[model samples]
Target: MAQTGWDDGQALIPPDMYTDWTAVALLLLTAAPLAIVVGTAGFFIWKQKRSSQR
Candidate 1:
């Protein structure tokens, strides 16, 4: 049977998972603002082209 005591070296098990919530939140926040700006600029450019074509 396997040992079941603190001195058995079980504490050496590596962590199975890790999460960086702050980095995720920062990426999401930055992407949203950049997307909004790019979308708005694209819309204006399309409108100007349509008007110029008339």
Candidate 2:
């Protein structure tokens, strides 16, 4: 962001979560486990409902 460091919030190539690879990797690594847990819970809920229906 050397190009727009002085500006407030708009940068052509800012190293934030959207465009920066390092930041994106950090975010994915942090959120992957939570995402897996959410998916597992959803699958279990679906299985439980299906079993009850049958």
Candidate 3:
């Protein structure tokens, strides 16, 4: 079997270029619930105002 080596001639990215995927995942998870709460509250408030005006 031939031993394969990295192509050193190619440009390489810095390690930090790979941003923390875990943090992104956590943020998305947290945002879902928060968005649901805000949306639900706004919906109820709008409904109440609409009914009162009718």
Candidate 4:
């Protein structure tokens, strides 16, 4: 008889699920500043409208 050392079994992950981390990170970076710029502009516009109404 011969010994095969050990067996670790099959992998848990499926083969079709791949991710592109670089693109995800780049998207997050771009979204954060764009969100801030749009939010600031909206706030100032709202303030201007409020002050004009008084």
Candidate 5:
């Protein structure tokens, strides 16, 4: 028999699992917008409070 070069212990992702990446990407996409909106609101509120304290 010819030598099969790959090691038996190597890890590989099968093609069917590729869709899992898309699901994760969608989750991040949803989270990013929410985070941006919350951050912006918090920054504005902080600035308003700081200016009012003078």
Candidate 6:
């Protein structure tokens, strides 16, 4: 069989699937840190209250 250009199979991804996801990506990036900070602060506050009650 003669070699076709597609034999290498380079163009797998469709163009529309390439739409900008930077905002969504950034939201995820920031949300993780924010959640961590809030969770840590809440845990400390809870620990303080629990110790005070003893």
The TM-score values for the models, in the order shown, are 0.68, 0.55, 0.67, 0.69, 0.62, 0.62
Give the winner by TM-score: 1 or 5.
1
**Considering only N, C-alpha and C atoms within 3 Å, which residue pairs clash in candidate 4?**
none
Which numbered prediction scores highest in lDDT against the true structure? 1
lDDT of 4 by residue, 1-54 (tens): 563333334545545557889999999999999999999999999999999999
- Candidate 6 root-mean-square deviation in Å: 5.8
- Stretches off by above 4 angstroms in model 5 are 1-19
Worst ten in a row by lDDT for model 6: 11-20
| Candidate lDDT (C-alpha), each | 0.85, 0.81, 0.82, 0.82, 0.81, 0.84
The 10-residue segment with the lowest total lDDT in model 4:
3-12
lDDT score of residue 18 within candidate 2: 62
Better of 4 and 6 by TM-score: 4
Q: Identify the runs in model 1 with alpha carbons over 4 angstroms from their true place.
A: 1-16
Q: What TM-score does prediction 5 earn? A: 0.62
Residues 1-54 of candidate 1 have per-residue lDDT tens digits of: 774554466766445546789999999999999999999999999999999999
Among these predictions, the greatest TM-score belongs to: 4
The Cα error of candidate 3 at residue 24, in Å, is: 0.6
TM-score of 1: 0.68
Candidate 6 local lDDT, 1-54, one digit each (tens): 786545567757644466569988999999999999999999999999999999
Off by over 4 Å in 2: 1-21
Deviation (Å) of 17 in candidate 5: 7.9
lDDT agreement of model 1 with the native: 0.85
For TM-score, candidate 2 versus 3, the one ahead is: 3
Off-target runs (Cα >4 Å) in candidate 3 are 1-15
- Cα lDDT tens digits, model 5, 1-54, are 674444344647543444678889999999999999999999999999999999
